[model samples]
Target: MMIHTEPGIIKRDGVYFCSSDSFTQDNLFYILWGAVYSLDSPYRVSRSYMDAFMLQYIVSGELNFVLRGKTFTAKANEAVLLNCREKNLYWADRQAVVKWFHFNGKNTLPLLNYIYERNGGTGLFKKNYTKKIEPYIDSILNEIHKKDSNVFSISHNIYSILCELSAPPAVLESPAEKTIREALSFIQSNYSKSISVNDIAAHVSLSTYYFTRLFSKYMHLSPHTYLLSTRLEAAKKILIYTFEDIETISLRTGFQSSSHFIRAFKKANNITPNNFRKVFYQKSID
Candidate 1:
């Protein structure tokens, strides 16, 4: 089954960069395109404290890029990938236009590395991989252009690129940490059920007593409290998006009853479900 998903976005050839026009696309995938331009000299911008990763495929002119205290120049057709939460400075020189994407959500790091490795870790222009990578970049543009583009495809493509860029495993190590991560992943996947520490411990093949200690050591919360937090988080999502009654939301989020759910929600958020919804919705509309 195809999972419909929203694409994270950056615009290429958008109003910010356009001399006389704008470009837009409508894919289930989110591809936002925008540009910055100047005629007399180079236009430069500096970004700090961002949430996602950015990769630019320069379409025209020259770009001076700074990453991790190092600077480099990228001419037309060359690309650069910035890892998440990194601060970088870049400027364009002499009539420059760039096609860029700001991508996030799951596997972004791997994708960035994959693109870098494929381009020989030096310059995107020297590696003859644009023909190979263009399809993935174009996928973003095409999805934005389409009336019904599947965002899942774009997400999958990004994940695929990440997988390619990641280094292969060296040796098996840190079994305890791996076990804990697996246990937490299981909890995240099964939070909507009546779950317990024993269930999760068994899934990870550990004694409940030992799992409890180890989990608290690593995660700073018992499995039971963790499950409660996860359920409360799910309920918060429902409360924000749906007008479903309290009982329905409680059941859907795996609480035994509305009263139980309400207590948990109030404890976590310091507000009743209805009040939380009303205040948030009111603020959103305003």
Candidate 2:
């Protein structure tokens, strides 16, 4: 990949090749590219898409990111995930330093999805998260700096970094939370089925009205919205990782019809499903 930087910026990039033996044991998670960048003047990057997941951590100063249609500012000790197969742009506000890694394998998407969902569907993670994962990134970079080709070592470090980032924050629940927890678990497990709030209420032995209120109180979303978001999330994963037709994906994600799925997806993502796939796939081909 080619990145254009302004005159005052400095960038050091490393690309890794895994050996056959390392590939056999740690093929599911590995790094493809890594870089450290420092900018003292205005700098910007525009890319249609990338074929691998990218994580950028800000060491100092600030960086601004625009993806799909959302803009985010990541300051010192902040990090962000740029999903594969999407149009995005990032630039230094004025001066910044960042460490970045590009990684992909069998387990990459799931980890990325976990991070995305945890951050409320936004790619930006909080500063404490950046602090936690920085050491793991440094370990990976150290291996590359020493010209170590031990793919297994690099892969392990990458997985460690992901594990650190994906660890869920602990939350204490009241004893009365059993119903909501069970309801949430059910939705997560059965979002691909033709299930409704009534069904969820019945499963939890509560009246629909009471159940809806309880769910809304604890989850900050009514059961209906939660189900819709769950289905949409599934559809997004399929859209990114599979080549199945839109109708097939819609059906598989429990949408009643393709048109409904398209409208719902557009409302959530600001882009139609076909256009999303087109932009991403076209960039991959190029």
Candidate 3:
């Protein structure tokens, strides 16, 4: 992790480091490093990348984050879930006290992406809206301050926090939530076929125009994009788990042709299907 901080500010931080072996374990999440810090206004940091996710909870005051040319703010009682594997900037918008951790493990990156998408493409989780995990974070801080590491307990707590993040807010009442849920189920069930906005709207008994707007409002993405994503995920699994050729895989994943599949895959992932398989298919490599 390369972090450049503005000079001439008081900073107090508590941090923890886990063993290198913890990073590669299956079904386990481990903190790589973390610290609780207090910073003054105008204090800032910039990093090209850190190979982990950073979860920071603002205990007091506010922090502003900049990622991929967009900025968001987290005031006291809010949280920041930053996928730090890219260039980013953050600064104390006011005097601030924050508890934070950096962690990575199985499914962490994908989970971070999920949260980011649902968060309206920002790191801030909205003030007072996600305070349920504050206690879990405090437990992590207690672990950080300990002499011996309880890796399993920390992993369990981290997963618990993830579960909280994954839960739909209790405020999402029925009918509307029911509609989105039904739509999601349908897409998941039939993404491997030629389904369209009209088909989905008809399935939910909604007008095409209304369904499109409702889906975007609830899902933060158009139904078409969501369907594309589902197909891409299916294709990725096939690529990783099977040695099938691109044309067959594309057809199985609902793409019109290998050419279209290749184009879409490359556009989304910046890597061709063949290369993605070669790079990520450990079974093949083995």
Candidate 4:
């Protein structure tokens, strides 16, 4: 495929190209190239005819596309896949970044057709469903860079991702489910803030009582417990990777105080923050 109209990206973006033998081409789904690109708005692709299926997961900003006489937009956390051989057009309508790839295989086109038909002739996957498959895509992206690419495993993962895309609920999402999804996304973004259950419920426009019931029903954890778990996880990473003081780490991770942080961490991990750090350091030295 030709990059027919790119002024250039705003930042340095990296990509890897993969080559496969005849057996792989005949048997496995294989990546042609993949990258995490921070693209400029003026970037566009109208040229076609290189035969492959293009899949992109938007990380930020927006992308607009015209495929099979239909137009669509992919926002952050959404995904789009289409046949590259079609008379299609797609561009970054705003400054956008994505984890994307062009892949080819014996059965790729058939799988794409199934996925499009399943979604009523569209390839856009909503944020909720795409979340389920990002880890598999991450694996494929990492494997494509290895000295000896695991073609079989990559093929399985690509097939798994496609299979997931091909299966959305009969009805896209229920109102309750959508509410919970929005709440989860909000928590991911705001977990570093000193936010409470009330704050979270307010953000989602629900009463605290109802929201707590719904959150527990869906996630099997109370909002308070989940929030504390998020903070503790962040503190653990800090303890292992940085020399930041425990108090600073506690405050930054949204804990009310260092003592509270220590108590919670020990309850969760059976070890204090300082002891955890020392153990990690000792392991590295050993």
- Of the candidates shown, which would achieve the greatest lDDT relative to the real structure? 4
lDDT of 1 by residue, 24-134 (tens): 122221333333332214345566666666667666666787776678888776666676366677765555566566556644555566655654453234224343455
lDDT tens digits, residues 238-266, model 2?
88888999999989888898999999999
**Clash count, one per candidate:** 15, 0, 0, 0
- TM-score on alpha carbons, each prediction: 0.42, 0.53, 0.56, 0.59
In candidate 3, the residue pairs with backbone N, CA or C atoms under 3 Å apart (3 or more residues apart, or in different chains) clash, namely none
The C-alpha lDDT values of all candidates are 0.65, 0.80, 0.82, 0.86
State each model's C-alpha RMSD to the native.
Answer: 18.4, 19.9, 16.6, 14.9
Rank ordering of all candidates by TM-score, starting from the highest: 4, 3, 2, 1
Off by over 4 Å in 3: 6-9, 20-24, 127-129, 169-286
Q: Which ten residues in a row have the lowest lDDT in candidate 2?
A: 16-25
**Of 3 and 4, which scores higher on TM-score?**
4
Off by over 4 Å in 1: 1-173
Give lDDT: candidate 4, residue 8.
39
Model 1 residue 238 CA deviation in Å: 0.6
TM-score of 4: 0.59
